[model samples]
Target chain A: MSHSYEHPRPALAVDCVVFGLDENGLQVLLVERGVAPFKGRTALPGGFVRLDETLEEAARRELEEETGLGAKVFLEQLYTFGDLHRDPRERVVSVAYYALVKLSDHRVRAATDASAAAWFRLGDKPQLPFDHEQILRVAKARLQAKVRYQPLGFELLPPRFTLAQLQSLYEAVLEKPVDKRNFRKKILSMELLEETGEREEGVSHRAARLYRFDRKRYVALEKAGVNFEL
Target chain B: MSHSYEHPRPALAVDCVVFGLDENGLQVLLVERGVAPFKGRTALPGGFVRLDETLEEAARRELEEETGLGAKVFLEQLYTFGDLHRDPRERVVSVAYYALVKLSDHRVRAATDASAAAWFRLGDKPQLPFDHEQILRVAKARLQAKVRYQPLGFELLPPRFTLAQLQSLYEAVLEKPVDKRNFRKKILSMELLEETGEREEGVSHRAARLYRFDRKRYVALEKAGVNFEL
Candidate 1:
C-alpha cells in the first residue's frame, strides 16, 4: 500500500533527553553517532519516526536501540523543535521527550548506530549535533522549574532514600542550596512520603532514616486538591 | 529544487484553540469548515503547514485566514496530536496551539474557507470535527491548571479591569468560586497589578476602580525569586 499527498511533508523524528542523578551531580545520557552528518559526535539518542509507532514509542525505541538501557521511568513530552533549517539535510521536525531514570536501575551500553553511551554532568557536557543542544537546554530548564512543584525528584533517587539524599536531588536539579530544616519540614508536612523503618546502609558518617515515596497517598491527596510545592 | 524521501510521511497541520472571556464566561473560537471531510462542521481554526513557516507561524496564519482576528495575543504550543485515525481522509499530524485573546480586542469574522466564525461558551460548544474536541479538552485543562500558578488570567481580561472582573475571570477559567477577601489580599500582596486611577463607565451599578497588570513588576519579581500562586 502507498500513500500520496499534494503538499510536501516534513520528516518527523523523536529525541530523548534521559536525566539521572548520582553522587556527583545531575547527568544527561548522550550517545556518540556512528553515522555521517555528525559522525562520531555526541548527541541525544533519537531516530526517525517509523510509520507504525507513536511519537513516544518511537522515542523509547530509539533510546533503547542507541543506548542499551530500558526501564519503566518518568517520561513526558518536552517540546517540539521545527525550525526551517533545524536539519541540515532536509526539513525535519523533531518531537523531543525528557526522561528521568534512577541511576542504579539501568546500566548503559552503546549499540546500533551509536559508538558509545555515557552520562555526563549537564553543565559540562560536550557540544552536540543538530539542534540537540537547544533541546537539552529547554529540557533542563523545564526540569528545574517543574521539580519545585511536582514530586519528580523521587524519580532520580533510589526507592528508599534519606531526606538528605532527597534534598541533594533537589539541589542538583534546581542548582541552588536549599535550607535543610525548611526543606524537611515542608516535605514532611505534605505527607507524600512514608518512613521505611530503615536507615542508610554502608556509609561512614551518621546514618539517616530512609523513607519511600507513597505513590497511592500522593494520588489520593492530589485528587483531593492538594498542591505539592517545595 | 526538489526533495525526495523513501518513507511515507504524515501530512502536517496546525490548529489553534483561541480562548476569550466575556460577561457570560470563558469562550472558544470555532469556524465552520467549507471543505470536504467534515465540511460545514464546527472546528478550531487551522490549516496545513507551509515549507517556509514555523509551527507557530502556521498557527497564527491559519488563525488570521480562517477568522479575521489577529492582534498580539498570548500564544503557546499546546501539544502535537498524531493519532493514526484522527483524520478520515489521511494520516495528518496536527501541532495544536492554545491562544488567549481579549474578547474586546478581536471581533470574529468568517473568511477564506470558513463559512462562519463565532465564540461559544466552552461548556456549551458544539460537536467539533476530527480530534478537535479532544484537543479543546486538553487546552481547557492546561488553561485551568496553568492559571492558578501563572498570571495567565490577566490575558483574558481587558488592560484596565476591576478587581471584581479579575476575580470573575479567574472563577470562570478555574470553574470554581474564589473567596473575595482572600483573592483580593493575595493578588494585591503580589504587587503585580497597578491601580490605573480610573473607574468602570456606563454601568448600572457603582463604578469600580480599574487596575492594569504590571508586566514589568511581575518580571522583576519573578527574577527576584517570587512565586505567583493563587
Candidate 2:
C-alpha cells in the first residue's frame, strides 16, 4: 500500500544473479551498467519492476532484456534488500533472484541495453553496486545448500553429463572437495539418474557414461525431503 | 521510481508471522483485525508501512504495536507477497517477516489497536488474510531448515532448559523424532551451553540439568560454519 505519510516511497527494483557452470568453475553473469548510476560499473543484471508484471516476471524480463536470456528457466527469489541509503539517489528496495543455467548451453552475449554482459568466475567477480556483492554471496550460499537437498544442481550441467561432471559441479558450488567413493555411493543410491548408454566423446582418458537427471524422481524426492548431499 | 503505467500505485503492507514455542507446542501470534477489509477476522499482525520507516522497521513496529512485543528479538525477512487480488480493496504488496521468540518471555496480550491478540498453535491456526497461510508455511520451513545450521533455534526455548527440553524443541520443529543419545552427543559436542548447576523442577521423575545457550560462542561458531543439526 502507498505510504500515506510525508516521506516519499522507496523505488522498487528487481535484480537477477545468474549463475552458470563451466569447465573452469562456478561463474556469475555480470553486466556493465549503461545508466547514470554507476555508469561504467559492472553489476548483477536487473532493473525496476514494472507495473504490468509480477516480481518473478520482472526479473526474467530484466535478465532477457539485459543479457538476452529467456524466461523459461529456473528462477528463485534470493532475498529482498531495503536498507536505507543502499542507493545514493533514493531508497531503492531490490528483490533479488538467483538463477542457474548451463554455461555450455546459454552463451552470454551483451544485449542492446547493456554495455557488456559476460560470465566471470564467481571468485573473481568485480566489485558491484548497492550491496550486490552481499546479495551474490547469499545467492551462492543458497545454491550450495539447495544443491545438497534438491536435484537443481543439474540446472548448471548439460542435459547429458558424466558422473564426474556432476560431482565437480557439487564441489565447485560447495567450495569443498568431496570423497569420490562416498559421493558416488550417496548420489547413486538415490536412484535419480538415468544412464543414456553414451560416453564422453572428446576425453582422452577412461570414458564416463553420460547420465541425465531424472526429473520425475527428482520432483518426487524433493517433495519427500530426500537430502541430495553429494 | 514510481511506475508510469496506467494503473495507480498499489498499497504496501508488512505482516509478521511470529513463532513462539510453549507447552502447547509451536505457536504463532495472531491479531484480530479492527479495520474494514477483514474486520474482526483473525490474521497476522501487520499494518501499512510509514513513508519514513524501512520495511524491516515497519515490520518490527507493526509487530509490537499490534501484539505488544518489543524489538531486539529474533526477526528475519521471510518473503514478499504481491498477488494483485490478494487484497480486496487494492493491490497490497506485503513484506512478511518471521520472528522467533521464547513464549515464556513474552505472552501475547491483546493490543489497543487490535480486537484481540493471542497465540494459536501453528497447525491449528485459523485461515489468515491474504497469502499469510502460505507465508506461515514458508516461515516454518525456513525455521526448520535454519535450526540445523544456525543457533537461532534457542530463541524458542527458555533461557535455562534441560537436555530433554532442547531435544524436544528440535523434534517439534523438525517434525521427526531424533535418537536421544545422538542428539545429546551432537549438541554437547558444540560446547556452547553453560550448565546452571540446577535441574528442571516440578517433575515427578528425575530432574534434568538445566543449561543456558552461550551467545558468545554461538556467534563465533556461526562464523566458522558450525551447524547444529539433529
Candidate 3:
C-alpha cells in the first residue's frame, strides 16, 4: 500500500540539548552550522530524521556526527517544536531531546556535518540560530525542575563522589545557595546514597566520605511512585 | 528559497487523548476511524499535520473536526511517537497530546472525518488501533504522577466544588484510597483553594460548602517555582 498526500508535509527533524557539568557549573554543547539558513552561526547538534531510525536514534546519531559525543549518555525527549516560521527554507518540525553527560569523561570535537563543537557556560552561550534558543531554554528549565524531584543530577557526576560535590551540583543547577546543614540532613535522610567507605584522595582540608548513588533503591522507589522532593 | 529532499520524508501527524471525569470515574474520548488504516476501529482523534498550523494547533483542529471538542480545552503535548511501523501505510511520525475537560461542560458529537465519537471509562475502552493504546497508557501515567505535585486535577472538576470532590478526583486519578485526614491537612497547607461563600444545592444528602481553585495564586507559585507536593 502506498500513501501520498495532496499537500506538502513538514520536514521532520530532531535536535539535542546536551548538558554537562564541570567545576564551574552547567554547560551546553553547540556546533557551528555547516549549512544555511543559519550557516556559520552556532546551533544545537541535530539533523533531519531518516526513514530507518527512531527519533531518539536520530538525536543520538546527530549528536555523535556533529559533536563526537557517544550514544551511551543519558538522553530523554524534551519537547516538539513546530512553529510555522521556524525554518525559513522549509516547514520543519523538530522533536527536541535533552542529554546529560559527564564533562570529565568525554571531550567533544567537531566532526561530520558541523564545522566546530564546544561547550559553553549556560549564561555565556552564543546567540543560537533558528528556534534553538527557545529549545535550549526549555531544556534548561526542565533540567532544573526535574532535578528537584528526580535523581537526574547523578548522571553528570562521577560514579563515586563526596557530599560536597552533590551539593555543588544542586547549587549549580538550581542557581541558589543551599543551606548546608539542612541540605545534608534532607539528602542523607532519603537513604538513596551509600557510603563507599573511602575518603577524598587529596584534599587540603579534612576529607569527606565518598558516596555512590544507590541506583537499585532509586529505581524501586521510582517504580513504586514515591515522591523524591529535594 | 525552496527546499527538497532526495529521500522520502516521513509524514507528520498529531493525536490527542481527551480525558474527562464523571460519577463513574475518569473517561477518555475516542473516535471510530472513518478512513482506511483502521477503517471502522476506534482510535484517538487525530489527522495529518498541515503546513499552516503549529503542532498544538493541528491537535486542537483534529480534536474539533473529529470529536466536536472545542479549542478552549486544557491541552499539553504529551510525547512524539516516531516508531518506524507505527502506521502501516508509510513512515509516519505523530506528536501526541493530552487534554483535560470537564465532562459536564461539553457534549461530544461525531463529525467531519470520524464515523462516531464517544466517551469510555478508562479501563473499559476497547482495544485501540495503531500505537494509540501506548499513548493513552503514557497519558494516564502522566496524569497520575502529575496530580501528586500539580493542580491539574482541578481542571476536570466543575468550577465550584467541595473539598470532598477534590479528594475524590485525587482518589480516582491515583486509583487508591487516600487517607482523609492527611489529604485534607496537606491540601489545606498549600493554600491554593478558597471558599466560594456558597453551598452545594439540590443534593439529597448534606450540602457541603463549595470552593474554587485559586488560579491567580497558583500562577504566582508556579512562576516562583514552588513545589505543590501532596
Candidate 4:
C-alpha cells in the first residue's frame, strides 16, 4: 500500500530555550549534539515532532530526552521559524518554545542523544548550530519585555525567597538596576507575596525574611484587572 | 519523477485574520468559501502553502487572491495550529497571521475564489470554518494586550487622524471606554504624535485637529529605552 500527495512537505520540529537563574545571574541550557548534521556542536535541545503528540508535548519530550530536565516548568510558545535554508538536511519548520525553571531545583545532566549538557550565562555562551542563536535571542527579548508586565519571573526563583532575591531576578532579566525602595513599595502594594514566617537559613550576613508567591491571590487580582508592573 | 519518504506528514496551510477599524467599530475581513470542506461557509481569507513561497509570502498571496485587498499592510505571525482533527480530509497544520489595515484605505472586493467578501463586526461575526473562530479569538486577545504597550493601533487609523479617532480606536479594540482627557494627556506626553496643522473635513460640527504618528521619533525613543504604555 502507498499514499500519495503531489506537493512537497516541510518536516516539522520543536526547539526549546530553557532559562534558569542562580546567584551568578540568568543562564540558558544548551546540549552538545551527538548526531549529524551538526554532530558534537552545542545547540538547543529539540528534535523532529512525532506523529502522535502536540507541539508543547514535543517540546517537553525533547527537553527531557536531550538534557535530563523535568517537564514541570513555565513553558510558552515563542515563535515559528520557516526560513527556506534554516536546516541543511531539508525544508524544515520549527515551532520554538521558551521554558523557565528554578536553577536550584533541576540539576543539569546530559542524556540520550546529547554528549554533554550545561548552563551558559546569557551574554557569554558557546557558538550554536543552525538557527538556535537567533531563537535564543528572540526568547531573551520576550522574557525581558514580558517580565515587566507579568509575574512569570518568579518561576526562576525558589519557593521561599527574600525580597532581595526577587529584586535580583528582575534585575538580571531586565538588565537594569531597579530602585530598591520603589521596587519594594510597588511589589508589596500588589500583595501577591505572603510572609513565609522564615528567614534565610545560611548566609554570611544577617538573614532576611523569606516570602512565598501567593498564586491564588495573584489569580484573583489578575481576574479583577490588576496590572503587575515593576 | 517521484520522491519517497516513509513518514506521514501533515498538510501545511496559512490562514489570515485581517482586522480593520471604522465608524461601526473593530471589524474582521471574511470571505464566503467557494470550495468544499466548508463550501459557502464564511471564513478568513487563506489557502494552502505553495512550495515556492515563504510562509509570509504565502499569507500575503492568499489574502490577495481570496479577497481583492492589496498586499500592503502591517502583517505579523500570530500562532500555529496543528490539531489532528482540524481538517476532516487529512491532518493539516496552519500558520496563522494577523494583519491590520485602514478600512478607508482598502475598499474590500471579492475576487477569483470567493463568492463574497465583506467586513463584519468582530463581536457579530458569522460562523467560521475549521477552528478559525479560535484563531480569531487569539488574534483579538493579542491585539488587546499589544495595543497597551505598542503603537500598532495607528495602523488601523488614517495617516492623519484626530485625537477623538485615536481614542475610539483604542476603545473599540479594548472593548472598554477610555477617559477622554486622560487618554489625550497620556498619549500627548509620549510625544510620538506630530501635529499635522490640518483639520478633519466635511463635518457638520467644528473640525478637530489632525496629527501624524512620528515613526522615526518612536524608533529613536524605543532605542533610548522609552516605554509607550497607555
Candidate 5:
C-alpha cells in the first residue's frame, strides 16, 4: 500500500485538557510525568497512542488510566500540535482534547504509575511541558466561545442544578459578571432547560428550582437556529 | 529517547477544506484524486506529510502542489480524524485544515497530478473520498459560526469592499438572508472597518463607500471581549 511504502510515519500521542468549575474558579487537571524527558514536571494527563486504538479511544483510555476519569465524561478534540521539535526526542504529533467534568463529583484518584495527579487552580498552574501551556490556553478560549452558543455548561454542573449554580457556571467560564435578570431571561427563553421540583437544602437563603439540561430539546432547537446565549 | 522507540505510528496525511465566495454563492475547492484506492474520485486537496517539515508546512505544501494556491491565504486548523478504518489501506491519521481565499485572486488550476481541480457550490459538492464530506460539512458550519463573531467574512472578499458586499458574504455562507438595515447597524457599531473614500464604479445605482478591515483596531477590540456580532 502507498501509505506504508512511501516513508516512515511520525510518532502519535494524545493529550487531554480537563476543566472543572469550583468555588474558587476553574481548575485544570495535570499529571506529573513519571518517565524521562520531562519527568517530575506537571503536564496534562496523556501518553502515547496505541497502535490499535483510535485517537478518541486513546484519549479516553489515558484519561481513565491517569486520572480515573471514565467514558461518561464529556470530551472533544480541541486541536493537533505537530511541530517537529514539540518533542525533543523525535517527530511526535500530539492530538489534544478538552474535557468538561462536574466539580461536585470530585472523586479523582490518581493512578499508581503516575508520580502525582492533581487539580490546580487555572491561574496557579505550574509551568507545563512541551506545548501543553499553549494547549490549555486554546482549551480555555474554546470553553469561553462555546459557552455562549452551545449549551455545554451543563457538563460542569450536577444532574439537578439550581439556577444560581447555572449562572455561576456561565460567569466563571466567561470571566465576567452577568446581570442575573438578563441571564435568566435569555436562558429560559431558549426553552432548553427543564425545571424539576427540587431545591438545595444547605444554603441559608431561599433555594431556587432545580433544573436539568434538556439535551433533546436543545438539539432540536439548535437545528432551527435557536440562540442559547447568556 | 522514548520517542525513538520502535512503536507503530499511523501514516499522517493532510486534507484541505478551502472556501470561496462568488456571485454564484459560496463554493468549496475540490480535486479529483489520480492515485489508487479511490482513483478518479473527487476529494479534498491534500497529501502525505513530509518528515522534515511541520504539519502546517506540510498542509501548505500539499495545498500548493495540488491546487496552485499560495501560502498567503488565511488558514486555520479544523480538526483531526484518526479512525482506524478511515483509510481503506492502512492506519492513516489526517489533520484537516480550513482555508479562506478571495475568489478573484487565485485562478483555480489543476496541477499535473490531480486529474481536475474546481470549485463546486458548497451545497452541490459531490461525495468525497474517506470522511472528507463530513469534514467539509463541519468546516462550513464553523465558517458560518465564525463569520458572525470574527472578521473572517472579509477573507472571502476583495481588500476593498462595500457594506452590501459584506452583508452578501454573510448571507452566502449562512445560506440565509439577513436584514440589511440590522446588519449595517450591527457591523458599523463594531468600528472595525475604515472608510477608504472610494466607491464601486460601473454600477447603475448609487455606488457605496469602500472600506477595509482595520486589523489593529480589531486586535485591540478582540482582546476587550467586544464581539463583532452581525
Candidate 6:
C-alpha cells in the first residue's frame, strides 16, 4: 500500500552523531549504507521516520538497529537539517540528534540495514554522504559549547572516574588543555562530585581517587542558578 | 496536486513562539487560525514547510505570513514536536522556534491564513490547539534557562536601555525577584554593556542612564569561553 497527501511532502528522517571519548580524544560512530542512494558508503546511523513513532523514538530505534547501541545512552536532539538537495533521491528533512556513550560499553556492529558499524576519531572520520558533514560539525559545536554549562561529559565517562579522567573528558571535547589546578578548583567548588572512597585498582603509577557525579545536588544547584563554567 | 510515496510520511511544519518583554512581563504572539482543523483557535504563528525552503526559512516565512514579524528578530530553533497523535488530521512533525522581539516596536496584525494576531501574557495565554500549549510551555522553559547562560535577554530590549530595563528583562524572563545590587554588579562586571551617554526621556521618574549591549564583546567572550551566567 502507498501513502498519499494532498500537498507534496518531503521525506522525513532522523540521523544521529554519536560521540564517544577516551584518553586519546573524541570519536563518532558511522555505519555503511547497506542499500541504495549512497550504496556501500559510510554515513551516520539513520533512517526514514515511521509514522507510528516519535522523533526521539525513531532516533533511538535507528541507533539500535544500525549500530547496536543500547537504548540507555545519553541522547538529545541536536538540530534539524532541511536542505533541498541533501538527498540525491528526493527532498529529505532530517532531524539530527547527538548521543554520548561510554566508549568501553559501546560494542558496535552492523545490523539490519547496514553492512558495518565502526567508530572513527573525531577529526579523522571518512567523508560522509549528503549533508551529514555539516550535521556532525553542528553536533560537535553544540557538545563543545554545552560542556561548559552542563555536565553532559559525565555520560562519556565511567560512573566512578578520577579527576584526571573528568578533566581529560573536558579537554577532549573542548579540544584544549586546561590548567589542572584551576580545573580541579572550579569542579570541586561546585561540589557536584562526591569522593567514592575508592581508588583505581590497576594503575601504572599511583592509584588516583575515584569520584561519582552527584546528580541530585547538581540539579538543586542548577535550579538555584549556579554557574558550571570551567 | 496530490503526492504519493512508497512509505507513509509525516507532514512537516515550522512554528514560532515569539516572545516580547515589557514593563509588565513577557508576552507571546499568537494568531487565530483561519483554515480548518483548528479554525478560529488561537495558535502559534506557523505553517507547513515548502519543499523548496530550508527549515529556518520556512519558520521565517510562516512568521511573516501569519504575524507580520520582521525578518530581523533574534530567532532560534527551540525543539521538534513529533508526538504520534499531535495532529488530528495527520502526523504533523513541527520544528519549533522561539524568537525574541522588542515589544515597543511590535505591531501585530493577523494576515494571510490568520484571522487575528495579538500578544498574551506568558502565564495568561488562552487555550491553544494541537499540542501548542505544551509547545509554549517548552519555549518558556527554554527561555528561562537560556537567559542565564546567554545574553539573549538583550534582544527583548531596545538597543539603548537603562539598567532598570535590563534588570526587568531578567526578572521577567526568570519570573523571580533578583537582588538589584547583585544583578547590577554581576552585569557590570561582565562589561558586555557600554555606556551610551544617554538617559531615559519623557519618563515621570528620574531619568536613568542608558547603555548599549556590546555584541562584538559578547561574541569575543563567548568564543573565549566566558561564563555569562547571572
Model-by-model DockQ, in order: 0.43, 0.33, 0.47, 0.46, 0.45, 0.75
Clashing residue pairs in candidate 2 (N, C-alpha, C atoms within 3 angstroms):
A1-B11, A1-B12, A2-B11
Error at A181, model 6, angstroms: 4.7
Which pairs clash inside model 4? none
Residue A224 displacement (Å), model 3? 3.8
Worst ten in a row by lDDT for model 6 chain A: A106-115
Worst 10 residues of 5 chain B by lDDT: B106-115
Candidate 5 residues lying further than 4 Å off, grouped into runs, are A1-6, A108-115, A203-208, B1-5, B108-115, B203-208
How does chain A of candidate 4 score by TM-score against the true chain A?
0.94
Between which residue pairs do clashes occur in model 1?
none
> lDDT tens digits, residues B47-147, model 3?
99988999999999998888788898899999999999999988899999999988877643532324488888988989999899999999998998888
Which regions in candidate 2 have their CA more than 4 angstroms from the true location? A1-7, A108-115, B1-9, B108-115, B202-205
Q: For each candidate in the order shown, give its overall lDDT on alpha carbons.
A: 0.87, 0.82, 0.89, 0.87, 0.85, 0.89
Best candidate, TM-score: 4
Weakest 10 consecutive residues, lDDT, candidate 1 chain B?
Answer: B106-115
How would you order the candidates by DockQ, starting with the best?
6, 3, 4, 5, 1, 2
TM-score of each: 0.92, 0.91, 0.92, 0.94, 0.91, 0.89
Backbone clash tally (model 1): 0
The list of candidate 6 runs beyond 4 A from truth reads: A107-114, A181-198, A212-230, B108-114, B179-198, B214-227
Give the best candidate by DockQ. Answer: 6
Write down the DockQ of candidate 6.
0.75
lDDT of 6 by residue, A7-55 (tens): 9999999999999886669989898998789989989999999989999
Error of 1 at B188 (Å): 3.0
Candidate 2 lDDT, tens digit per residue, B77-189? 98887666778876567788999888887773532334478888977878887777888888888888888877777888888999888888888888789899988888999
Fraction of true interface contacts that also occur in model 4: 0.24
Model 4 lDDT per residue over B100-219, tens place: 998887653432334487888987988888999999999999999899989999999989999999999999999899999999999999999999999999999999999999999999
